[model samples]
Target: MEAAGEPIPLSALQHAVYCLRQAALIHLERLWAENVFTAEGAVLHAVADKGGGRHARGVRRVMSLPLASRRLNLAGVADVVEFPRVGGQETPFPIEYKRGKPKLHRADEVQLCAQGLCLEEMTGAPVPQGALFYAATKRRVVVPFDADLRALTEAAAADLARVLASGETPPPTPLKARCRACSLHDLCRPEAVARPARAWRDRMVAAEVGPR
Candidate 1:
């Protein structure tokens, strides 16, 4: 729980899940760098970012919907939230735009679930599920806001709030695969920075073993 402060950004929840250090760098250090992948994502969100509402296929589609949850202390703009009639009542169905396909990790799902939580607070309606729309696949992967996912989202929010308030950037956890896709790769320099730290740890271990 944040106790008191600005609401944590919903996107920070994803960053926290993906890598806590990455979240700290962006939220604490205010660092950012764009790359091809991020540009593609921007293109995908161009229209939705404009922010408006419309009715399509009997569903009310709201773009760039601002969402906030006091319970989680999270706030951000949902790319698209469709209010489709469920049991004769309008229910929020958040649709997040992404550049890549479904990932093995649950970072994206956590973000979407946070949006559902915000919607539940704002609309006083149960947000049971949402969707992640991948630009590459051009498909929507439906996500249920089950107990596990909701728990993960809440946990991410708490972790993110803690990191942001700590006022210190977390150490780099270098992963070749994940860092390669990050827009802040150059700024992060995970490999360059983590190598020396890893080497130092190895040296300490060797020293402790005493030539074994």
Candidate 2:
């Protein structure tokens, strides 16, 4: 903790780590859009955010809990945390909610790992693993907080801090795939940018070829 009354730095780290343009839109522009995907995600989160404590067998489930780790510069709410006792000692297992099914990308893993790090810091317990529940798939994917993931999480936090401090909206590196599904497609105008770049490159090539 830096000091009392100090604002805890935002963990827009996940946004930056996932996509620079997305981070810029949210942090720099304060713009947001809720598409169908985001709406479904919000519904899932709303159910999880309802505070309640439940016990099943030997596992206790806690919901909508605020968690943070100053060491990791991470702050977020864990959707669900399972505390399982072994030999009369409580161990934490974090669970995060996702809007879609698992993909080839590791963005979701990064988010889950950050949450686990926060749980460890807040509770002073070893959190070796966590899980992400996908609303679309209706399944849970387990994530291990290994050394590599921890390093990535920490680096992401630092990168987010740099971006926020700079207060600059980063230019979008538009990909056809990203543009197709991006919620900010209209705002970003990635296709327009890509077409111009392609045209410029073609003109340069034509000039070099001498009217070819």
Query: What are the lDDT figures for the candidates, one per model?
Result: 0.90, 0.76
Q: Per-prediction TM-score, please?
A: 0.90, 0.83
Tens-digit lDDT track for model 2 on 93-192? Answer: 8888888788666767877788888888888889999998988788998898999988987787766666666776766677666556667778777667
lDDT of 2 at 15: 65
Error of 2 at 66 (Å): 0.2
| lDDT string, candidate 1, 21-133, tens digits | 88887888888888888788889899899999999988899999999999888899999999999889999999999987899899999999999999999999999999999
lDDT of 2 at 152: 87
TM-score attained by model 2: 0.83
* Number of backbone-clashing residue pairs for each candidate, in the order shown: 0, 0
| Minimal lDDT window, size 10, model 2 | 1-10
